[model samples]
Target: MTFEYAPAPESARVDIAPSYGLFIDGEFREASDGTAFPTVSPASEEVLADVARAGAEDVDAAVRAARAAFGPWSALPGTERAKYLFRIARLVQERSRELAVLETMDNGKPIRESRDTDLPQVAAHFFYYAGWADKLRHAGFGPDPRPVGVAGQVIPWNFPLLMLAWKVAPALAAGNTVVLKPAETTPLSALFFADICRQAQLPPGVVNIVTGDGRTGAELVAHPGIDKVAFTGSTEVGREIARTVAGTGKRLTLELGGKAANIVFDDAPLDQAVEGIVNGIFFNQGHVCCAGSRLLVQESVQEELLDALKRRMSTLRVGDPLDKNTDVGAINSAEQLARIRALAEAGEAEGAERWAPECELPSSGYWFAPTLFTGVTQAHRIAREEIFGPVLSVLTFRTPEEAVAKANNSPYGLSAGIWTEKGSRILWAASRLRAGVVWANTFNRFDPASPFGGYKESGYGREGGRHGLEAYLAGPDDRPGERHGEEEDGRAS
Candidate 1:
């Protein structure tokens, strides 16, 4: 059977180029090594654009640009710099539809998520940090806080624009200049973000976007000029980055992998719990670092919750990413699909019973049926590793303590969800859970006012709120009287 996709709002609305190059020093330039890579649409496996493959030399140029802009950009009164961030945020809003469409086309996420969740959050992140400019002096690092000289940031492909905003906004807000590398699989959104910076007329070197694969990211991270490196990706890569930068005096923060446990008690609200579980593990086809892939149900309610979960999973719509009605979309790339498949296979081999929602996945694009594995013991591979797909592993716990024990068993402490009617149980589980972000009676929720990060292998440092600004900060000498962990509360923007 052949299926046709409706045109994306911006796919037909904008003028897209045949090729995109690295954005450095306020211009588009080819990779220094003259290498190029093809970016394909995960929704259809069609070649979308040829992006420059940056090498070490290109990384140098981008870092140099960022370092050059640091003085003037850092010297600018915080309010003025804030204005540029605001301008970029406004541009993002103005072109939200185009950005959203292009995002879905290349990134393989639902258009609705690209439109509502990713795009809005991207804009809001900038806007949130925009207000933080100039306010940092009043921010609790003391009377004054100095900007870190140059930041090197590498973001994942899962949530392209949002991750860009996560890197850019906080860096700009805290007064640091940045050289950022977007994931090779989804470089289009970063190029568009660079265009918005150009439109905002932000200073020539304040932000530079270099496009490439792992090698490029490694170059950006290990560059001597970068005073700090902030990264969002897999735990393995994050560890390698940490090792490379060890003892270099370069500050670092990593938001890495996760195998979060979403626990539901017997007395919890079933309907809301079901929705949270669906959004937790299935949203974005469960590609999120903080995704809740492990489900821990109180033993008494195991059968009831499993029934509702399967029933709800069956209703999910998986197909073209451009469709506004899509509930689950294409897997990000072929390699990722293979990894998810391997993990799913491991689950079966480990004696877990796996089931998929009855839906037809696309033939051309990378696809995985929304999957769930029941009868999953703690020892099962599905419950232990990060599958990073719309696959969940269900386990049962005899008590709240057992739930907390099981939840904290994983080395990755990114995030977790708790569904319980008992206030004491909610507080207990939240406090005991090793994850950084605890969703009490909720799941997969993000806000500019909240802090998001992980505890152990999931990585460190918080993004969002005042804590998020710390990544861009330098020594205490910049602020003569600042104390660590003391927030400058009650100050207006």
Candidate 2:
């Protein structure tokens, strides 16, 4: 069946504002060259609106404006900064539905996820960090912490608005100004977010949105005025960014790629483990950065778990993102769909048995049938690479030590899931795993009050909780405008 993008208002859901232009210095304006790109609805491959394609000149101007705002914004008392974040959070909550519709339209995530998970988490992010604004001292900082100036934030297409919250909220609450360039693929919701900021009466230039692809992101990163760069993207790009800003005094925090493992011990509750394993790999079509794409099951329960997983996968609904019953949604873009298809082909070519749920995919829009591969080994490309799609690699192991070895084998160690009945084993796994977050008996659970980031090549720095504030602040006795978050430890409960 061909896909259609039924307007949110036509369905009596909500009305979304058409978003365009480069938001800079608190003004929504056209790109420097007046060039525009059509933003596509992933559900229908239809043009949603003409979006600004920020040129290098626009990026420079945005960075300058952010730098200018940084002095005053950074000097504002933490209490005042906290209030601004509070105001923005309230505004986001007020316009949640509109934003949710736009998010689903652009990102191809089900309306359920965009509304229930993404929007709520985005707001709660601000709410969580807003309270931390005046409590920096208790956050292990000095009595008064200074803000880093002019943060250059480049967020990924996956979870665009939530990434905005991850990047913008703590920066604002810690008294820093930002020049944010969202992923070119899913720029709509963030543009709408700029409008909400205007309504919140946030100081002009405190937060700016420059829309463009990786080229625009490069410009923002290389801009001389930017004091720091925070990025959430692929590991390849993160490496390049690290190299580009190597010699500069600029600070960098990267949340990069992942090929996380979901380990199922023989003693685990089979029913719960099966459910957790399914959700870990297939939720959001497996677009999550911390997706448990690698399944390591103990040999004792491997066959039983595999049968349960196939049944669970068959129940997922793959259809219109707006449908109330939809569980899996469209692939975000044709390019992403192609990537997923290509990787799945590779998995088969490399000697894995590929299996996709028996479901029809819409023809016109980008879509991939949920896929899984059994008989996978560490040598399989599917097991080693971050497919970033609804593809799971199944592997079996014998002991806890072997499971840990397999889980940590990936160069990417972002997050891991452990399913076990023994509390001691759970604690041992959590402690031994190099991942930033460990879920025991649960998978893919997120709370705004939690600090999230990865270890090693998966990237550095945290994005939530009190730990997030450290990335944006300086101790009171530090040098003028110097960053003091280098010593910030991750101790979030």
Q: Top model by lDDT, which number? A: 1
Supply the TM-score for candidate 1.
0.94
lDDT of 1 by residue, 464-483 (tens): 88889887776566531121
Candidate 1 positional error at 365, Å? 0.5
lDDT of each: 0.87, 0.86
- How far in Å is the alpha carbon of 312 misplaced in model 2? 1.1
Distance (Å) between predicted and true CA of 323, model 2? 0.6
Q: Which ten residues in a row have the lowest lDDT in candidate 1?
A: 484-493
Steric clash pairs (candidate 1): 141-482, 142-482
- Model 2 lDDT vs. the true structure? 0.86
lDDT of 1 at 217: 95
| C-alpha RMSD of each candidate structure in angstroms | 5.3, 5.2
| Model 2 pairs in collision | none
